[model samples]
Target: MAECAFDFEVLALDGTPLPLSQWRGKVLLVVNVASKCGFTPQYAGLEALWRAYGPRGLVVLGFPCDQFGHQEPGDADEIRTFCTLHYDVTFPLAAKVEVNGKGAHPLWIWLKRQKGGVLGIDAIKWNFTKFLIGRDGQVLQRHAPTDRPESLARDIEAALA
Candidate 1:
């Protein structure tokens, strides 16, 4: 089993392999995203965070997930187009993934094991669940789906510092 965030591998929206090790020495906000969720608007704030802190060693990674209410039923191409046209999201986006159950992505499994959910539950309750990983590849915190991206600025700043 992987001991840290950098030990995992994910797929990009284009179906390219993306190793978390490539983001060594940078703070990462890993999110399970969905295009049709009510929290979908959070993409703007996520993009803002990316643009605001990117030069300072912060990277926001979005992983489109379909496990929550089938909210992200779109395929890779459709997801890419929706994000670009609606949110103008510029941060890196991963291919559609399952964030819960046995089919969950490895990175997510590690994240849940590391931080768990509110009250120590391991299951992700909904889309937009966020995991904040430090530059050292350790998970710093897990934010609830209702937590706005902007609300995470303080912790992100601290992690970057």
Candidate 2:
């Protein structure tokens, strides 16, 4: 078994304790999301992936972030409202956080350590970056901001299988 890639807690937009451990035994797609980024529309694709694979053990977790280009300037409430009103998103969204920098969220720090992106760099370059995690809680893959959620169906299916 691979080593656990994450051990941290974050807040839900509603202030609930968002526990990474709750997702054990499920395939998780952890995304750093921004409301105003160019890739914002990816929310629709993510929702589609969730609706299609959720029952089969796929969980898409959105972590609202403003670390890139100030694209997500909203607070937790505003972020939640935008996601629900604009995309009808039913997936999990963590409270607004910094995904890079010295104060980056611990969960993100742990995630980057497990699956550094191209060239083995751990820093996130933009919003909508995706991290695929296996049922064993290990990070399996890292997809760039431009990679559509639908493109990940094959990997998700393989993990679930």
Candidate 3:
């Protein structure tokens, strides 16, 4: 396994290479998101967390994934538009990625290994699964799809401190 979260590189929604190394010292909330999922409204709380704690070094990265039920079937542009128009999300969003199975993104593979979900399962169960990374680039926690972003405030604040 990689030493830290910074050991991987992913692509931005615009197709630009985004190395997690750039966010080395920042607390990161990495989430696998989908526009059409039942948990889609969590975007608002995520954006709220970003806006509220961004200046203090919190970076919420949304990774659009279509692996679950084809909930996020849109292209990068459509995903971006939906997030902006519906949730007014301003945080950085990566291009579509596979969070499970053979085609999973490398970063996600690392994350799952770092902090497995319920019953120690490495596979991501659904859309909106969240991974919180500490400022030191270590995986801190794994949140299930049902866990709301707002519910994570205390943990986020602790990580920032």
Candidate 4:
């Protein structure tokens, strides 16, 4: 049986396994992101958060998902280039993965179980859905697709403390 967020490994954009264990004991902002979604602009805010809090033990992990509206249609390289050129995003990004359904990533499945969405819907509602994971590798909070990255600072601060 799985234990915590560290139990899973997601593929990096380069297709190598990236283990969550590597970031154990750090506050994590895990976001299911998309390139063409209306919230795509949030990438700038996310990068800002990473730049501001990364030095203080915060890690922002972006998981590209194309499930909703086929928003993230690019391959890994395309996604990488877009993020770098547009948002100047410096955070680590995972390869595209489904955020819902049977093919949903294990980490996401476990996360929904930990903190159900609004109205108790565990499945992701749309792109840009975010989850905050504490240093202990457990889900700290589940954020709506509409929630801005900057709005999460207070909760992240409490978790870091």
Give the Å shift of residue 93 in candidate 3: 0.3
The C-alpha stretches of model 3 lying farther than 4 A from their native spots are none
What local distance difference test score does each model get? Answer: 0.94, 0.89, 0.95, 0.92
Write one digit per residue (lDDT tens) for candidate 4, span 88-134: 98999999999899999888899999999878789999998899999
Total clashing pairs for each candidate? 0, 0, 0, 0
Residue-level lDDT of model 2, residues 15-59, one tens digit each, is 889877787789999999999999999999999999999999999
Q: What tens digits encode model 3's per-residue C-alpha lDDT throughout 1-161? A: 67999888899999999999998899999999999999999999999999999999999999999999999999999999999999999999999999998999889989999898788688999999999999889999999999999999999999999
Model 4 alpha-carbon miss at residue 75, Å: 0.3
RMSD of each candidate?
Answer: 0.7, 2.0, 0.8, 0.7
**Candidate 2 runs further than 4 Å off:** 1-6
What does candidate 1's lDDT look like per residue over 1-161, in tens digits? 79889888898999999998999999999999999999999999999999999999999999999888889999989999999999999999988888888898888888998898877789999999899999999999999999999999999999999
Ranking by lDDT: 3, 1, 4, 2
TM-score of each: 0.98, 0.95, 0.98, 0.98
| lDDT of predicted model 4 | 0.92
Better structure of 1 and 2 per lDDT:
1
lDDT of 3 at 102: 93
